[model samples]
Target chain A: MSVYPISSPPSPQAVMDTSFWSLCCYCGLEPYLWKVWARPIWVPTVVKNQIFYHAGDYPDQQAFQQAEHEGLLAIRDPQIRITQFRSGEREVLSLAQEVSATALIDDFSAHRYAGTILGLDTVGVLEFLVSLLEAEIITLAQAESAYHQLVQLRATNQGWLKWAYNQIKQRGGNP
Target chain B: MATHPQLPLTPEEVAELHRLIAWTGLEEPEALHKLVEAGLAALRLEAALHLYATAPLSTGEIAEQTGIPRGQLIRTIQERRVAPYEDPTIDQPALYRDLDERLKRRVARWKGQA
Candidate 1:
């Protein structure tokens, strides 16, 4: 007899777990509709520099640890890009050979520094979230709830969530 | 018998007189004298109400019709001192229905054309 049956009896304990259970149920019910992995491009150096500068009052130890936890730093392969510039020219002469993903950043100075100086594609998180919401992978209610949670998290971490929320709210969502 | 010679009314003066008569409903000498001073203020409100009832007009159009400064009109509308016409896209037939119902109530009380 096969250990993994085609239709197995459902476990009651599995239903109560919101995180893994929801994902499992969604996958089991709609196997064709599941998105297993997101191929998100992470610009580690850019993220690390921004976090280090902007992470106020948090100890260097804690900030470094948090950055690792948040997957802001690349663990396995450290991809470093070196660029050379000529005198009196505003642009960089050369760029890195390999770039998997671009960083989404909010800080104006960091954005300008990365975009103009390093030639990286920097997008805002709220704009990205709006696009995700519009794509229907995430419902509007879910997006709103997640945004509220993110606001609280940002307030705890960065201390300007209220201003950020107000700005984003003023720019109406896609109808 | 009239003591003074009548002067022809300009288009603006005629329109202003019509608005004043619509608002005051008075033609007596005492009322006319009172209206000559307060007529513009009363007509200004009537003009606003007409605009509000009919459709949403631009600030420039409202200013041109009522002689109220656009800034003042905007401030009044924003502060809810005067209600503006609702946008057709957002409100649809419900806005017109509500306005019509309110006008009916006011006309019933006044026993006159609204």
Candidate 2:
């Protein structure tokens, strides 16, 4: 219910959703996203719980654990209580508010809540990819490849994916 | 060796996909995106029990206030015979049988590993 403004970007510490991390892992772009955009990313305790639940089963589990061990990603509990969103989204949004960090969320409703209601500068998977493209951290070919990977994973809604592709193209990315 | 998986679509298919993307309009209605604003489903049940005990409200009234379907409220209250303080939501018994079966299998696997 609390609103924050997106005009002045928050600190570079990224509070991300589990889905975004999973998508990055699927495309082998997790490290790239962290290094280029997140800049010492953090996960909410609930997100960490999801990671653990997927640890032995998911391909990205080791990367997440390794990131935590290396201090590139830290998992902390959200100070505020929120129940309207799913476990991961709720924790990430609260943590972002608690720390005044940028929110990198992908779920549509949760994304809207953070960006529109909370006034946090929010980034989605597409925006993160576009950032990589603009920064020249990822080649156009890599971006295209990652997009296909996302499609295969169905990590995002199909309609949103199409919209995101158009956004990327508008930004002069060759995708 | 291939460094990555092959592109799933052919060039023609990819262009067709681009065309499809263009055809599809963005901006879905906000109403379609709405979810319950607050309260975990489990906590809602717990709160309903507390209210029933404290307020002496009828079961139907509690169901209406809590947004729980009336029939489900009846079953939860009568069939489960849930105590006011006991947490019935600890196990998701209302989940689909298939999911419950799978979770049981997973817990069994973990138990065996231990």
Candidate 2 lDDT over A122-168, as tens digits, reads 66676566555655557877888887766665535444566546645
lDDT, each prediction: 0.35, 0.55
lDDT of 2 at B26: 16
Q: Candidate 1 iRMS, in Å?
A: 25.4
Off by over 4 Å in 2: A1-11, A37-39, A55-57, A167-175, B1-114
Give the CA lDDT, 0 to 100, for residue A171 in model 1.
47
lDDT of 1 by residue, A1-175 (tens): 3211223221111000011111212222112111211221222332233223333553432434543454332322233334331110111111112333333333223333544676554333333333334434456555565566444323111212333344346445322
Worst 10 residues of 1 chain A by lDDT: A12-21
For model 1, what is the error of residue A45's alpha carbon versus the real structure, in angstroms, after optimal superposition?
Answer: 8.7
Q: Model 1: per-residue lDDT, tens digit, B1-114?
A: 121134354666656666645534545353345445566565575455456434544433454566664334432442343433444354434533432343344234222211
**Which ten contiguous residues of candidate 1 chain B have the minimum total lDDT?**
B105-114
